[model samples]
Target: MNSWLEVLKPEEIEEIHAASLEVLEDVGVEFQLEEARAAFQAHGARVAGSRVYIPRLLIEQALTAAPERFLLEARNPARSVWIGGGETVFAPPAGCVYVQATGTARRSAVPADYIDLVRLVHQSTHYGTNGGGIVIPEGDFGSDEEKFAWLLLAGHWYSDKPQMGLNLGAKVSRLALDFSRMAFGGRPGCRILGTINPDSPLMFSPEMLASLLIYAREGQGLIVAPCSMAIATSPATLAGTLVVNNAEILAGLTLAQLVRPGTPVVYGNTSTIADMKTMAIALGAPELSLLVLGTAQMARRYRLPSRAGGSLTDAKEPDMQAGLESMLSLLSTVAGGVSIVMHAGGILDSFLTLSYEKLIIDEDTGGMAKRFQRGIEVNRETLALEAIADRGAGGNFLDHEHTLKHFRNEIWRPQLSDREVYQEGRDYQAYTLAKATQAWQKRLEGYSRPVLPEEVEREMLDFYHQRFGSEPVLDV
Candidate 1:
């Protein structure tokens, strides 16, 4: 985590600081709704139409009030996640449209696709958390709400990885809480994921506010996202965009803390830009990468857990552009010490489409990033100053005891990515995309759904049935 600070020179930090202050003072931010304007005004902000002037002092005070670190308790305490300060967490892309399967290259993500994705995530040792509501196979479910419901059900059924629940209305939030209560067998605060969108002013919608309150009251962690778009929905400049994003996030954090102080929440930013030329959202832009890393730092300033965009690219096809963009943004966030990096796979066009090949590649990228975060060991054996002197020059250490001891520990072995020569490893027949397909298939073949007690599952399903007036399909 200290690496993040070390990477930023004093001048750079000062620049970011100055930019933040300018954003707070000169650029300001827009509060779309009157209620949010009223809230900010009540909270000592100056409001002029939709533009609000937030004093640096107020921003600093809010930062002071924000919790620096918190623990996300899982149903199994052993699996609980510490999301702030020193620890780091990862999440796959959410709300994507396609999934890659084994044997097949890529396929449209449907309800069944969700089930497979959940199962795969559950079984993977690599991924630390589960994200449902990813648009794999477009669900047969009636509406976005219904599709979200299916995601919640699949998450409950497939994984115990402290999953993110669906982001429907307040009723779904309540149901999700109830589902957690049942799934964990009355364990409160089992670390379910909830979202609060700051698309308007400083305030949350009644439904969203209620959801946050429910999650907070239950001791659940929240992932609040200010889906700000640069040069469009938000400020055109990066600094201005960051400030608006920060204010929006700060607003969510303040509300959550006020509702239930000390409730764990991640400072998540999915802010991106609409391309000036194409009028399309561009995730591959260098500015987006900088935004992600910068947001991580700003979140750290508040001593809060952080989440940011990752495995994101503007490429239509999963090619070099996709790999490069994903690697750059993801590594930046990881190095910036973001606790939860979402969009780790299957995102395109600012997250409207999901690519199976991209997902496979991203898994490799995520593995590499996690390895990078582990950093280099500085133990006596690893320092090897003495060993180097002993060997002098031109001595190969491959067969040495020190080499054997440190090499494995120092190196990261990738699954989907290839490093072999053309003649070796089946003539490098297995491309990462293909390997990912195989691995995903193998995982599904061996997949075992979480063993929820029959009665508990029945109760949860019954509740959904009663609420929706139909038997909830557990197929996915």
Candidate 2:
């Protein structure tokens, strides 16, 4: 792999790490869960009510205990993905309650839309793992439990790829593990990947800590992410925000290690600058990429897999703004060597809406980014000295055997981009929208839901009925 993109110098990284340690040792982090506070107190941390001042020794121990990488297994073994070890895995977007299609008004996503989005990820050539909470459906289930059940069940039924776990709380986390075991059958290894976000400004909510502890004790992969909006949840300056972000993540990592040593933990950062006017986190800002770069550097320093960046945009539509912003963030992610890329596709309108057209467009963008990450292979074969000799100056090699043999793998062909000469017709944006719409429609039409065992499907259906007491939403 090419050299990673670095925003922080080596000395600057040490300064940030030292500052974060100081913050953890002084200001400390608040843990709302009693269990978390007790664990910290037992582990030589100073516990004051809900706040725990973690010592540098504890942080070092946790960093040493956490594994650098792990494997996430899928029902279909071929679809399994490696979470770390210099791997860059693209997962779909999560937590979007609204969805938009080309030429359609933004509105609450329904059950059918969720199913369709799952199918899109299942058919995608770029996305690897089907991230949980792909969309929070409206009027679909009666409660969070029912909604989570549908999301997990439909994700399994529609896609056999590796999946991330639901981190809503303890109940949902347990539900994810139970469902995974029902499908994969008493697996000893990690079958689900999960991410827990610490509430910004150095705080961990009870529900998040509960999920973190549950996942850690169960030996599931956990990502401790802190989304600190600069000047809002964290300090105004980017460097100050990094200090806060690192401290919160370190606290969570130490807690995970206390619960279960050698747990797979990814240092995650979704921090960015807040829109000065609205005070909302701006996903499209260039500073977002800088934070991802800095976060990756910090994760490398700790020798852990890092998760950050995505095909992010704040555009209301999949237009020029969306394209530019998404590409900028995604390219930075791949260049920075983020191991697990969250929100890689389908997000829009400051992550409030998931656009179907943008899903297809971002797939192409991700493909391009991964291709760029691969860089150039300059071996004997690729050197093409023999081809140059075979085809003298001014000679054509288009029909050569070497050209025919390597073109497909050597060239990154785009699925959505039109490379032909332009013609007078609809505008570029209109053309792109039409193409993306057709692409998703084709994928849905051609999609075949992955088949599950009869016993497993029946067991899941029984559990659904017993738990939710409602008919399962199995339509795709």
Candidate 3:
């Protein structure tokens, strides 16, 4: 991870600092709601209509008050994850519709489908960590509350890693907390990945703020994702947009800290742009790649963990375009040293449709990125100068003991993928997509669902029934 090139040098970072200060001073952000305007005004900001001018000193003070690192606790403490100021961590993709294939066809994602995906991810040795409930099924129970319910159910079913809470209204947030309490059997800090969405112009909705407050008071981790679109909703310039986005994140962080000091928060940015001609959000543009890298750097500057948009593609089909775009964004974020990187797969055209095959392909891409982050070996054994001298010119290293000692450690083995000769293909004829599909099927077949105590499951269900007035449907 440290081997990757520094996108911003000291001078560049200084320039960004100056730019941010200028943005705060001159190009102030607007808060359309009067209450938010009054809050900022009361906090020493200069408010003119919807626009609020924040001084650099306040920004610095907020940065100082914010934490540099934190832990995301899980049902089991062994599964808890630490983010910030360390090796880059990879998380599977979040929030997509149909999972795409390498081929043109796509399939709708259901709650059960996401459970299977989670099982497969848990089973895979290659995937770094489990993020959350995979996909929300499109059906009669597609309300935001139901979506949050599904997330809670999925978290209950799986306990291998830190599970993410679904993004929903404040009522759903309370229900999710209830569900977590029931599933985990204890109310531990940082048990769930609490989320809050901030709309553009550096402001969060009241409901979003309320949800974050709930998580903060509980001492759980909070992920604030402000979906800023360049040239339409957010500023066109990258730096300009980053200032507004960073300010919004800082504001949320301040509130969380005020509620509970040292509360875990991840700096998240899904800032993108809409193509002017067609009004379609451009997920594959170079600007997005830049944003992914720059936002990562900004997160580091704030001394907090970062999550950014990824596995994005503009391709209608899961082909070269999809692979290229996803790889570019994924590599940039990983290289930029983002912790808890999100959106690993199942994304297209601003996260509307999810491609299953694309998801599988992204898993493979993530494997490659992880390999890159492992980087080159620097030890004497890796250098192999003595071996080179002893072998003289052109001797076979494959048969040597040194090769035997290191080859397995040096090489990465891939699953659900092939690297065979074409002439030997008839017996091994499956393509990458077909193999991935088969892998998922095999995973589903072999999975053994974790056994929660019957009493605990009943208690969770009873709580849901008490809250929502019905026996909660368990999709697992």
Candidate 4:
């Protein structure tokens, strides 16, 4: 019941695994950073100049050592989540450059927009964890550290769930780790979760490798994801892309375990095709769904959890095209049995823009998938055999106790994305936009900021002062 669709048979899974092993052993992968190359060489991987040929046995060893499941401890203990074991977690869309809403002009996001987005995440029932790097807030920062400090602080200030941010550099990521130590205060296990992306065509960037090493040492959560464009960065065929993508992910996993034997890493991906005519990345393609399905199968083979797929669309607005494409992509991701889907909401124009209106649409779309994911509970009470027996054949059960008791949990309702509500005076297109706008306004107006202790808030402020010139004037 985990998925309605299956892409790879058991034998096909073996074939893909063998191909990836061959690629890792014979073809080798380039390490753009000397430090990462040194780690592999130190761990007995054969290094040829800047390229490193990792042994298949080492890959198997790492896979055996990596945990099948783990806890990501949040700042609020009650908000902590367990990843893997077929359980899925949803994070709102993040890392978009531009922000747009219905009837409002599109523009670069500032600090206010970033804070608003974080607050919106805090208010949503659909998001399992707080989203991070939601916007690259506009600021005149003295350094990258300064910029990162403000952004991560905003994330902490706004939400209590597990959060994420840029993980390609060492200095800023380590700083974030230090902040987390203060935010969560020595809670056991993983408190920090991050996404470290590999350069497609089999390479890990210097910055990302540095970040990965720090995360591994800190016992933080990681999604060892590679974002490879099918025709551009990988072989055009889907099978070929999977082979490359798997090798890249395995190399990262191996490195994570090498730094720390039991490092928690998800077998992650962002592999999608390039549009033939436009040369733009095609996230809404049918092949993208297949890619996710295949990736999830490989992850299961290694007994690791998986990540990828999203409410993605190339449409510039939250219109009919966006709705259709987003629903299809979100459903495919859930059916693929993937975990920790990134960009699951608010993406538009292939990740160039984040539409507030679209975020509402995307959230509702993902909510539908979750409703489906709950499946059916066939217990004695849920079976309703007694209820039917109590009420005779001709008599209705609408007024019965069973119906009254379970009606709310039994029904799936969409607050803002009801397709049935679109047939009246307005088009589905216009209704969707208007409703999305209306939903966000209500959420913002209604959400109350979480209270922070005076001492902890002051310490966070001191950390802020060390990074930026002055202490932040926060509402919390």
Candidate 5:
């Protein structure tokens, strides 16, 4: 394949690494959890209260011990996903609390919305990683315990694809592990993956650390991301923000290694720029793609799998702006060699809302990105010298067997984008919106919930009931 995309020189990457090491050694990172701090201290890091000064030796050791790639098992064996190497896996939008449709005002999402989102994910052809907790229905769900349980159970009920583990806290995270064991059995390797974020500006929060420790000890895959907004939580300059981002990620990665060596950790980045005047984060900005490229390069420098990019946008609705921003972000993501793509679809309003239309549109965008990542084949048959000679210069090759045999594999067909000539009455944007709306509704109409084995379903329910006192409701 082609070399893909890059945003930094080798020397620049080295500069970032050296600067990060200096920060870890001198400035230090705060590990809010005592266990995390203790783990760092035992691994030769200097500790003062919550601040842990991780030395270069520990960082290097951690880098050496961390695996480059790992497999995540799914309820269906065929749906298992490998989360590294040159592969790019797309996940749905996360943490959105509102739902929006075209020409309608956004509103608080309910449990029904969450379940439908899961169903959309289950039906999507492009989204490979099923990220549970795609949208949190805080307005409807009574308690954190109930909400987290519903998210986990809903994912099991709707999708057999590989699901992301919960990381809200140690308790919920451990519950996610229990569910994974119950559903997928006690097989080796990572059964599910959890996402953990640093507090940015050189800190790890207590809840995040608690979940991180649990995931590390249990040998589950972890994505250590730093979602610092430039000029707000981080430095105004991209390079400066990168220094802070790299440091925080390294600190978390080191802690995970200290807790358990050979842990599968994806170097993750959701860091983006804040509009200077308003101070609001802009996920759609070109700077986000630059950050994605830089983050992926940094991860590659350490020989680690990386996570970045998505169909991210600042648009409130699934309109033109959403499509433009989503394509740019996703294209850069695939070109930059991102392994796990979070928020790959169904996001709108700077992640405040999840739009069903965008999910369908972004899948087409993702298909295009994947096709581009495949690059072009140039050897003998692909060069088409025989086909050219068969047709000669003036005549067309439409009837040639070579054209017939090659076109299907060589061309990428979009599911949503129309290739036909526009009729006189059709409006392109309106057509897309109509098509996407129809598409998602049709999917939900035809959706069939995957059936878990009877005993496994009973065990998962029993575990849920034991953890949360009330009898759980499965119907959404």
Candidate 6:
């Protein structure tokens, strides 16, 4: 395993842990659902109204019970990813309502756009899973259920990689699971991942709890993330924000363990300070690097897999601002040793929209980060003193065996980025944009549908009707 980079010392993590425990025992966390409240009360916690005062002992127990690493079983077992053990996995942009496509203004995405994005992700070399990659709320389907069913069919049909499950609360979540079952011939596997986010300011909504319980009971991979906004929901200071974020993660992880011990739940967070003047969430601020590094330390303390940060930016388009900010966030994430990174591509405008050009650029960014994570090998073969001795001083080793054998693995390359020098006083930005646009079109037009068996495809459609009741038939 590659060595992990750290920003906080042991004492700092301890201080954060102690402060988080104090917050849990004093201020308490609110659970809107009766079942979640009851579960907390049943365990050793005191309940007052919707708030639950959890003791430090209960948190320690949950941390002890949770596994350090687990397999997210894929339909193709070879593609399965192991989360934890200093390993990192990445996914594309997910749950965004709008897309800023090439040569067009921002608009609500449709089904075809969603499918094309999935195909692109399936073809990308960098991403390990297509985790809830697109969120097209206003699709061609009549109902949300119908739209979701078709989306699942398309994702499962286009990619054999592991994927993310939907977050449509409890009742609708079942439809996605059933569809996945049909996709893989009724196998009870944990390929689909789900997320449980606490409504910030120490609260978890009823709908969030319902989905958490459903996904936990169904034996799926769960990400316990809290979207904490500093100075608005959390405290103004970064350390203070960590206390609030850690508490939410602990509460969610405890709930998952209580539902079913040994369940694969990831310790996750996306907390950042809000802009003081405008009060908007600052997703691309430089301070986010610290948050990502802190999340890694806390996850290590609990011995659970962690996730955060990505090719993220607050820029409106794929420009230089987007490039700098996304790289800053991404390098921090990779260095922090996050197990699974969400929104690692295509996110823009503080995550309100996705951009196709940015997606391509982010894939390239992820490739660079992955290569960095490999670190440098220092064995005798890599040392190559023999080759050095054979070549002598002032002699070029470009034709030597050592250089020939190692160059490919030793050097990094780019796909979307260009190496040609632009003439002075030329419009380089336009050239970049035009190149990205051409690349995006080339990939989408060249995509071919994967071979999902006829029986399986038919079963998938039948399963949709068997679950959705056929009121809104899919047009695709």
Best-matching candidate per lDDT:
2
Q: After superposition, which runs of candidate 5 have C-alpha atoms over 4 Å from their true positions?
A: 139-142
Which window of 10 residues has the lowest lDDT sum in candidate 6? 467-476
TM-score of 1: 0.85
User: Which candidate do you rate higher for lDDT, 4 or 6?
Assistant: 4
Error of model 1, residue 103, in angstroms: 8.7
Worst 10 residues of 4 by lDDT: 417-426
Off by over 4 Å in 4: 2-4, 419-424, 473-476
Q: Summarize candidate 4's per-residue lDDT along 1-476 as a digit string, tens digits.
A: 63546688889888888999999999999888888888889989999998999998899899999999888877877888888888778887777779998878779887788888989988887677775588776666676677677778878888888877568488888877877777776567788788888899889888888889899998888899888989999999999999999999999999999889999999999889999999899888888888988898888889898888888888887777877888888888887788778888899989888898877777779888877867888889999998999997897989999999998998887887555633556666676678889999999999887765677777888978976777664453
Candidate 1, run of 10 with poorest lDDT: 1-10
For TM-score, candidate 2 versus 4, the one ahead is 2
* Steric clash pairs (candidate 1): 68-303, 95-134, 96-135, 109-136, 109-137, 109-138, 110-136, 110-137
lDDT of each: 0.70, 0.90, 0.70, 0.84, 0.88, 0.83
Q: How close is candidate 2 to the true structure, as a TM-score?
A: 0.98
Ranking by TM-score: 2, 5, 4, 6, 3, 1
> Which residues of candidate 1, in runs, are more than 4 Å off?
5-65, 100-108, 140-146, 200-207, 385-394, 424-430
Q: Taking the tens digit of each residue's C-alpha lDDT, what string does model 6 give over 1-476? A: 35677888999999999998998999999999999989888888999999999998888888888889888766677888888888888888788889887679999877667777888888777778873647665755657767776777777878787878777777667766776677677777686888888988778988789988888887778899988888999888888889889999998888888887777889999888899889998888977888998999899998999989988888998888999999999988998899989998899999889898888888789888888878889998988999999999998999998999999999998876778876888677877777777877898788777677799978886766776676333333
Candidate 4: lDDT of 232? 95
Q: Better model by TM-score, 1 or 4?
A: 4
lDDT tens string, model 2, 32-150?
99999999898789999888999999999999999888888888889888877887999999999999998889999888988888888987878899847899888657897888888
**Pairs with backbone N, CA or C atoms under 3 Å apart (clashes), candidate 5:** none
Model 6 misses residue 5 by how many Å?
2.3
